[model samples]
Target: MYPDELERYHRQLLVIGREAQEKIRRSSVLVVGVGGLGSIASLHLAAAGIGRLVLIDNGKVELSNLQRQILYTVDDIGKPKVYSAAHRLSELNPGTSIHPIYADATPELLREVISGVDVVVDGLDNWETRIIVDKICYELGKPYVHAGIHGFYGQLYIAWPGKTPCLRCVFPRPPRRGNGDVIPVFSTTPGILGLLEANEALKIISGVGKPLLNKILVYDGKTGLFDYVEIRDADCRVCEE
Candidate 1:
């Protein structure tokens, strides 16, 4: 990062360099669902110097969230995720603009937020919402990064609209909701995947290393093993013709 930008980003530029810093400064990302996944993704992006971040989440912060939603503290309980997240994000980096959309991600809702955004990140709770996001990203020709955490496992992939396969091509259906209830989970799982999503976002924005296009990076926290699954489907409704 340039000396002037360094003065702004400080520690962030030390990690990503000036060029990546500039890209982050000029990019806009819309993150859906400000829970465990969205919380840290927003934190890292804001701290990393992303210019505009639109965070959308309809849920409210509850006491149970304290274990993983590091962005919020006990005092924020009962507050909408968007409001709580925006408050914390503003404190994290005042220079990074935050636009909090306190609503669920429906087709229409997403369309409104998707405008002018360079990328979309799925920090959502369910596969139903993910499919909506995938179609919207495809329609708008924007890159969409998908991240999900189930118990101790988390996965992420960058869906480059028209170039890489969308989430549906790999899973074919939204994962059944509440499956996490049946799996064992540690708070650190989402933390890892959320940062991975942020890393993919930076790579996409920075024109740096190759993105996680068409390949899902799966993390097994129990074993600390990372696996990549190549995904391609010519019949993908969202990204394929």
Candidate 2:
């Protein structure tokens, strides 16, 4: 590690050690979506010195996103999110390579992006897109970190292709999409869940602690309690294929 790199990540080095730090520096992560969840997760991933970071988002910054999306400012409103996020992450850690894809996560796009990525971060907004990410990652045999937030509640899980039950296995069918659904979201909700997602990504890359695997973690900010749900499917369709 260079002198500046060492200084920048010095504190974390104590916990993960230089060898693990090197692994982190040599790792590449594909973060899908750049909204509430993606904002926080990508920031920490770049801050932690991930060698290469790919950010994919299709939307532009809006006035409403300012509440929880920390990566953007008022000036960023009307600008493409991936551009603003990429610019900010580059400024945060020049050593970390940042690739910003200003496109939606189509099946083809997901396959292309996940090609060389070590891990996939599911920072998407809807379950439809989340299922696509899960399936593509599963077929490619890649590790995937999933998280979602709504109001005061959030859920997180990690899937390792064949080794763990995938998102589809846990939620077999997609929830009915409400007509013009606009669920209330607390500003702190995504912030809390996004960091957990980032923590999982780091551990997965560095081989530090267990990576959640098939277990799902749920956070209830209103009650200030955390719970876990064990997930496994021996005859899962996604996993079986």
TM-scores for the candidates: 0.91, 0.95
Provide the RMSD of all predictions against the true structure, rounded to 1 decimal: 2.4, 1.5
lDDT of each: 0.83, 0.90
Residue-wise lDDT of candidate 1 within 100-199, one digit each (tens)?
9887677898998887799898787777888888888877889998898888889888777667766777777666556345334489988899998988
lDDT of 2 by residue, 1-241 (tens): 8898889988998888899999999999999998989999999999999999999999999999999999999999999999999999999999999999999789999999998899999788899889889888888989999998888999998878767877888878775545666757899999999999999999999999988876889999999999998765534565565
- Error (Å) of candidate 1 at residue 10 is 4.3
List of clashing residue pairs for candidate 1:
1-17, 1-18
Candidate 2 Cα outliers beyond 4 Å, as residue runs: 176-180, 232-241
TM-score of 2: 0.95
Clashes of each: 2, 0
lDDT of 1 at 78: 87
